[model samples]
Target: MDRRNFLRTMGTAAAVAAVSSTELGAVTLGKDKKKKAPAAETGLRVRFLGTGAADWKGPDDRGEYRRLSSVLLDNRILIDFTPTDADMLPEGCKPECIFYTHSHADHYNPEALLNLGVPTAYLGKTWISKAWKGFADASAKTGVPVPEIVPLAIGETVVCGDIAITALPANHAIDATEQALIYLIEKGPTRILYATDTGGIMGVAARIAGIDPHVKKGTPITGLIMEATMGMGDKGDEDYRLFTHSSVNTVHRTVKMLLRRERLLLKDGESVYLTHLARTLHPTQAELDANLPAPLKAAYDGLEVVF
Candidate 1:
């Protein structure tokens, strides 16, 4: 089917499901009843800056909007710098470090990072030269000093304040020379797996599953922030598969693999959130909540979670 036809069909199904069901918010693993606590009081907090895929058009008058994907960690660390405008950032927020998944324009905006003035930024080892070029171009255009750029290797861990971050290899940008990274962040007892902008977890799942042995045995993952760019589309779609982004099928498969491998052990109250939404492929925020199972709802901008 053509893109337009596919989207129209999906939208219809989503609307139908939404009208018939009612369940919203983040998806949690297992089943239990516990009061949801504020992220500020919790050890780790994550706020999604933008939840749209690269193809996402800007917001419209009807309030259907999806910005490029990015997340703020405890308002101190930023995962990606896309759509990095003053309004997108939290008030009084200053990140100590910004982590880049790749050099994709939607994930990394040099001009935006220049304005933020973060002290340090991390990128894949293969991205240093490309990043330098971007920084140089931005500096010439904006007259902002270049921030320090650190190269990250797969499986290498870097300590940023209280958070221990490890960059894992991802299966993305196969045609490009630059590599992609998925982050594993840990603070106190809270551990979060931040995976986005990747097609599948096949190459990286084992490494992720092995992370538990490196930390305390019983320290389950406090949260999972994953990408669902393709939404509930068929995996056989050529355009979707070619882009190396996740669909509902791949996301579920990855989650199940993690659970079976004991890589991601969720405690009673932990939750899973799907971000990087593609408007054409997925339903609206409310419709998505109504359609998806518990602990697997779509994430929206300004949605904050603490674990």
Candidate 2:
């Protein structure tokens, strides 16, 4: 389908459940059950189901095991999926669709997609053909029907119910022919940049994020969920993952740059959460949270935030 017609069909097909006006604040799920600063009743809700990188083996220091990376938005849309996700999915969560960042095994799982039975799945246009074949093979092996696949190029935006998602080029790569991606999510006045599995923001993504004043600027981002795959301090500078992943130092520098450019908005508490943490590299979640600068916190599995 053409872009205009494609968008219209998706917007109607994936509209979320009606939002309630009740003032339910954000709360992280776990033994501690810490609550965040109160948010507006109509704020965008993001729940982290998994926060680990490709090396998903480890209990950290606190005996907490993070599955592969994935998130549920407003409890209706999912960002990435993995087989392990079934272990931690919130009760009553019926995700309408999924938006994948890339075709990495750690980020995308065809089995989970088939099992979950979401109606549609969207991803970067560069590798959609390969994805279609993969989905078809999976459908043939199993009895379930394949979810409809939608190809989205960088700089393209689609409306799904009350949310608007824009695809942006990521600095990471799986092969010479593929285009990895990050996402820009908009709901009402709340704008969030969900960047992972990529190096620091650069190229078209920088222009879209308003990092360069010379380029046409978009709306300021009200919140951010970025990856810090490398460990604390300056370890990422000399590590091999520096090219395709973010480090603690990289996140700090990027946040400072965004603040200076007035491109990012900070909330009262923890406006930014670092995900895709490497289990072998990082310390316990509490220690990580303690070391991060104010408003920039480490995200643990099952954490919830309303922006």
Candidate 3:
């Protein structure tokens, strides 16, 4: 089948196979939740809808699982709409906006949004044009309304409600011609640096994180949701993958750089959670927790962090 036909088939499957609420783990807030806040008053909450790299494999017993790389913020802002994300929209949650990190199929699924009806979507200029065309084509074929595609310029901050978001440069792509983005999201006093699908946090991202206009100096970020797709693998083991995804060593080095530059100032209990894990490079979640240092943990699907 051609690529277009394959995507159409996938979209049909995704629309029919929407996951049940049971598949989504129990919703729990962070340690700070003394009494559950009213639904209308719920503050910043982030949930990892998927936490695996593109090539991640399920265990033998499961046969096949569809956990891809995506994060849902406050159940209303979605970053990346992988197939897994499309299959599992949180119960009673309708995201107002969707943010695309790049044009990678894993990060941006045009079919997933066919029926979602999300009002606004933020993506790079190139991606915006591509998405508009793709959705228009799909809509003509399937009769679904094409969503509004807005351009997200790198280094420019866009505000959605109370949240202020800036798209920073990401060093990742299928090749030199492709473009990628890493987001820095700020809500109220809490700031989160969501950097994934990138080899390392350098260039414009490093500079922006080091001195963000929205965040005050010496104030630590509420959370740093980063990717560790290569685990602890050496460059010699896999040369091609290392150029786009980060390893455990890269995570550590980036963290150190942020600290050395006073870019990340964590409070007594704040932490960094790693996502987009590769099964081949890491062991079970239990083993990972037992071995990883304090404040750095491997995140799993349904994991929630409230700030």
TM-score order of candidates, top first: 2, 1, 3
Each model's TM-score, in the order given? 0.79, 0.87, 0.78
State, as a TM-score between 0 and 1, how close model 2 is to the true structure: 0.87
User: Candidate 1's residue-wise lDDT over 187-223, tens digit each?
Assistant: 6667788889877764454345354333444334657
Candidate 3: where is the Cα deviation over 4 Å?
A: 1-43, 57-66, 211-220, 233-239
Per-residue lDDT of candidate 3, residues 161-273 (tens digit): 45567788887876555578888877766678898888887576756655433345544565688888887647513656877888877877767666666667666776688
* Decreasing lDDT order of the candidates: 2, 1, 3
Clashes of each: 4, 0, 1
TM-score of 3: 0.78
lDDT of 1 at 172: 79
Among residues 3 or more apart in sequence or in different chains, the pairs in candidate 3 whose N, CA or C atoms overlap within 3 Å are 220-265
